[model samples]
Target: MNRLADKVALITGAARGQGASEAELFAAEGARVVVADILDDPGRETARAVGGEYLHLDVSAPADWEQAAAFVRESFGRLDILVNNAGIAPPRPARFDEIDLAAHLRLFDVNVHGAFYGIRAMLPLLELGHGASVINVSSIDGLAGVGSMASYVASKHALTGLTRSIAIDLGPLGIRVNSIHPGIISTPLVQTVGPARIARLQRTVGRQPLGRMGEPQEIAAMALFLASDEASYCTGAQFTVDGGHLAGPYREPPADPDETLD
Candidate 1:
């Protein structure tokens, strides 16, 4: 129950979904948690439920990062974990040749730049703590190719690269960085992509070996492991909890050659 005893964690996008799940788990594990998000009502409610604090944070803004980190410092005196979980996955570009450059830039600003700011802002404080961990919420698309989500994939790929680079640079400081790639999680963000899209995703996921979409708590469990000493030897690694979606093709059903096999 006290796996994260004495640790303080600041998680972005903690108003709901995987972010909220991680906040709940971290708090349950005995860490003081700070739930940061732009959704005031839900964020505050989540914090209250978990006995944590809520901070208004817009991840794309460097000033917001600075302010949130400062608040964490004042409230907790030190930071031991930072979960960069805030992001948006907009609809795929309308046509192959008609990529929305502006949308792509905005996606990167939040998915990639947000994590960068979070890490940079918390570096000093993290350095002071013992065995600090930085967990960036990426996606399976980051590691694999999906025809429709070019820009989203690119942003996640960049996040993965950033995680590896920081892991190398911060190893000496005792701060570990890693990325989690969640696939087909059930969240409001998924619903925002529309019913047809969600149905397609469900069908595609059903073909997976696990044959089901992942729950937010499943991802939260992995995040907690990475943040705790249980994963002390892990760093700069990409963890995929994608219901066997990446496990390659399934074996075709055997033919009825059974007629010959007496």
Candidate 2:
């Protein structure tokens, strides 16, 4: 335990999914975590469960971010880790032309712009921490495109670029930055389709070399490594916890019924 001893971490979207898992794990590892999310009740509960603080933060709003920054400074004195895990995805499948323009714009507001705001708002405290780490949770879509998620793909791709650019900018300041690309993970974000639909999707997990969807804890483990002193030399890097989904397509041709091997 105590992989993150004496660290103060602010994790956005900590009410659920990968964010919640990160908060739990960070606290277990002896970090004082701040769970920030728009979901008031659940966010507060999650914070209470983990003995962390909950801040009601709408990541897209600058004022909310300012308030969060103030709270962190006043409550923690210094911030050692910032996990930009809060994000939203398109609810329905849509071709590029069929996609709603407003929703598409909103995607960037939360997924891309929110991350920027987090980094900007927390920089002061980060510097005070001596050597801080910033973890941006991108997706497999960030590495490649998906058929129906045009806006999500675009936003995550932008996050990957943002991660790289800022890593170089912040490296000199002793703040390490990196992005994570998660494949078909079993999170509420992906479970919105309901249990039955999710079950069907699980069948396709075999297509990935790991042959199963990833768990939120699996992603949290990566975050811990990046946030802790263990990864002091790691920065501006994109880590893939993708179950080999991006490696390549796994396929096997059918055998001919009428043919026999000699």
Candidate 3:
């Protein structure tokens, strides 16, 4: 529908996976997209394929965000959408007690602090636009607890909170903010969790109502909605696109076992 016609969007971590999927979809919907990522080669390739531009963005660095914001302002004059999608999910600790403090700190630095900087850096441009939206990529882990990966879960939870608070603060300025809680999608990061770990994840998926993982495009579709005018009233909301992973109770009692089967 060209919902994003004449809009300019900046998507971080757009080299591959969900970020890349969103970039492609946004461009197709008539938004001029800027693919930003630390991975130079793939970022450029993906941007080229989508007929967009690629910028080297290290989300962990505040200075990088400043430069990126300036680049967008000079190039596009205004920014209508910002997607904080760059993140890392390190391997699960051998045990909860084995969690490395340094690793946890680094995770928060990227997942939490990076989003903070992105929002701050783009505020000027976003406010300049008639209406703008910020889409933060959170995870289902942010909503629930698991046996391992406490640190990663903690970071996502923080991001979700940040998203809500920002939405509250920015809504008056016509800038909407929202978080997306994605369940296990087929991404390289998930593959790196190893076969045994993947088996455990599969068991979790089997119990979900949909009995499978989600696709990147599915998440992108929700993102597009949130970024478009269709979601004009959807700020500070957490949308889950997890193949029913967040939906409660897939099992039902043996129906009418004691009653007559009509």
In TM-score terms, which candidate is top?
1
Cα lDDT tens digits for candidate 2, 1-262 = 9999989999999999899999999999999999999999999999999999999999999899999999999998989999999988887778999999999999999999999999999999999994799999999899998888898899999999999999999999999999999888989888897777687667667656777899999999999999999999999999999888888886432255474433
For model 3, residues 1-262, the per-residue Cα lDDT tens digits are: 6989989999999999999999999999999999999999999999999999999999999999999999999999999999999999855654557889888889999999999999999999999875799999999988998666888889999999999999999988999999999999988788788899899888778667776778889989999998898999999999999888778775432345484322
Q: lDDT of candidate 1?
A: 0.91
Candidate 1: worst-modelled 10 consecutive residues by lDDT: 253-262
Runs in model 2 deviating more than 4 A are 194-200, 251-262
* Candidate with better TM-score, 1 vs 2: 1
| Total residue pair clashes for candidate 3 | 0
The TM-score measured for candidate 1 stands at: 0.94
Query: Is candidate 1 or 2 superior in lDDT?
Result: 2
Model 1: runs farther than 4 Å from truth?
A: 250-262
- What lDDT does each candidate get? 0.91, 0.92, 0.90
| TM-score of each prediction | 0.94, 0.93, 0.93
